[model samples]
Target: MVALAKEKQKELVEAEKYVSEVYEAIKERNPHEVEFIQAVKEIFDSLVPVLAKHPKYIEHNILERIVDPERFISFRVSWVDDQGKVQVNRGYRVQFNSAIGPYKGGLRFHPSVTPSIIKFLGFEQIFKNSLTGQSIGGAKGGSDFDPKGKSDGEIMRFSQSFMAELGKYIGPDVDVPAGDIGVGAREIGYMFGQYKKMKGAYEAGVLTGKGVSFGGSLARTEATGYGLVYFVDEMLKHKGLSFKDQTVVVSGSGNVSIYAIEKAHELGATVVACSDSNGYIYDKEGIDLDTVKRLKEENSLRISEYVEEHPHAEYKEGCSEIWSIPCDIALPCATQNEIGEPSAKLLVANGVKAVGEGANMPSTLEAIDTFLENDVLFGPAKAANAGGVAVSSFEMAQNSSRVSWTFEEVDAKLKETMASIFTNSIKEAEEHGVPGNLVIGANIAGFKKVADAMIDQGVI
Candidate 1:
């Protein structure tokens, strides 16, 4: 018994040592990429148990290969603004991994688009795509082009110019880019038109978020939000609870949050609050999804406008205060690191029961630890927000087959995909002897698939 105990201790020590060495190497290489380092650290920390179980991953140097992107493309984007002045911006694409399938991800156009943020998103995409059980690898591209307050012509020009350079590196089979942040249906339409014009062929499969009139899937717009609720509903169901009669808070009035609010309402939950970059709106009578859509989508107004239409609702000036609105569930659909440790503790204090991340890495590592320590039913972004990409893959199939499905058909597929992801996450967690811990379960489940594919492909 003494000898066995010593052997187990030695194995654990070796695992911890391997994780620390690789983490330090990653930080040394990416000194200024704080978000990338955080993401890599989170995944690596979760994989220590997996490393002890499967030493072959270390033998094959998978950690080193996976952390390093296959190609990092950065370029200058110059376009003429409405004033005839030349506006310059930087664009980037990080094709992180392709062992599973073609490079697939979204192109974000927020001012926050840095190489660090893009790399962090791309790195997380690897596992997120893997969890979908679809034939799509991980990649992310974008520019620091803020579209707010920009005219239609200006956005069109910028999207076209951005794609003129980005188009060189992407295709249906090479890499497919979709909408994110400031990039949406209108922006995607402009970019797709440019790609079509440049190639002189209608390659509808090259982009995922094109207008439904072209080749976009029916439920693609609602996939991530609806998928988030679906996955969380499963978590709640596991605890013998449901979204029925639950009060919820969703941050962000964008596509993801809007649809998440819609779905939560459908599931008999009242979503009392949603936010924008400027501030958040709390409507105790439940957020009017149509009013939010009209304000954000059609009129392009701030979330504060919701109160003008509904006098009873209150608008808070800060975005982070949205977390302070007590509720049964909290969904952060806005951006990365939006929820810090303090906000997480506040949610816990308010008797928050669940947290489903609707955005990529929305919660910090410390915040996640707080939720876990408090026994909150936490749904990580990769597994919960994968509905969008899953539907994107479905759109790819439709484009290839030259047929489109009804909204019901696509939505059914998305719900099933979310349920499957939840099941796989828990099953993998239990198998790894960490039952009910979806974070470690999801990381391991997604990592194993990519790592095995890399091993079979023989060290590219």
Candidate 2:
């Protein structure tokens, strides 16, 4: 018994040391990529036990290969602004992995976009795509071109110029890109138009998030938000709880938050709060989704305007302070690292029962630790917010078949996919002796599939 105990202790130490070495190597290679390092460390930390259970991954150097992107394409995009002045911006497409299928991800067009941000998003996509049971691998592309105040013509010119170069690298079966933070229908339309003009063919599958009349999937806009709620609903149900009578706080007034608010209402929950970059609005009577849509999507205004219409509701000044409002659930739909350790602790104190990430890497590592340690039903972004890419893949299918499904059909499929993801995550968690730990469960489930595929393909 003493010998067995000593051997087990040695194994645990070895596993921890192995993962630490891999993580240190990653930091050394990408010395300045803090966000990318954070993402890698989070996923690697969960894989220690898995590595001990299956030494084959180590034998094949799967960790090393997966960390390094298969391809990183960067280019300069020069376009004529509305002022007739030529503006130049950096553009990138990191085809991180393609073992399962072709590269698949979104194209973010925000000023904060950098190589580190794109790399982090792409790395997360590898597993997010895997958990969906789809044949798509992982990739992410974007630019530092802020679309905030750009005119329609300026955006069109920028999109065209961006695609003129990006088109050389993507194809229907090669890689697919969709709308992300700043790239919406208008931007997608411009890019798709350019791609069509350059190829002299209508290859709709080359891109998702196209205008519905063109090739985009119905309910694509609502996929991420609604899927988030669906996944959370499952989580709540498993604990003999439901969304009924729950007060929810969802950050962001973008598509994800809006649709999430919609679905939560449908599920019998009152989403009292939603926010934008400037501030957040807390409506005790439940958020007015339609008014928010008009303010954000149509009028292009700040979230503070929500209070102008709803007199009873309060408008807070800080965006991060949304977590302090207290609720049964908290969905961070805004941006990366929005929820820090302090904010997470506040939520726990306020009695937040569940947290489903609608945005990628919204919570910092410490914040995530806080939630899990408190026994909060925390749904990691990769598993919780994968609905967008899953629906994007559905759009790819529709384009390939040259047929579009109805709204109800696509929505029903999204719900089913979300449920399956939940089931698989929990099953993997239980199997790995980390029952109820969705973070470990999701990471393991996603990593196993991709690792097996990479090993079979013989390390390209």
- Candidate 2 regions with alpha-carbon error over 4 angstroms: 1-9
Q: Which ten residues in a row have the lowest lDDT in candidate 2?
A: 7-16
The digit string of per-residue lDDT tens for model 2 on 144-179 reads: 999999899999999999999999999989999999
TM-score, prediction 2? 0.98
TM-score of each predicted structure versus truth:
0.98, 0.98
Q: Can you tell me which runs of candidate 1 are displaced by over 4 Å?
A: 1-5
- What tens-digit string does per-residue lDDT give for candidate 1 at 1-460? 9999798778778888999999999999999999999999999998888887888998998999999999999999999999999999999999999999999999999888999999999999999999999989999999999998899999999999999999999999999998888888999999999999999999999999889999989989999999999999999999899999999999999999999999999999999999998999999999999999999889888999999999999999989999999999999999999999999999999999999999999999999999999999999999999999999999999999999999999999999999999999999889877888899989999999999999999988
Position 324, candidate 2: lDDT:
89
Q: What is the Cα-based lDDT of residue 171 in candidate 2?
A: 95
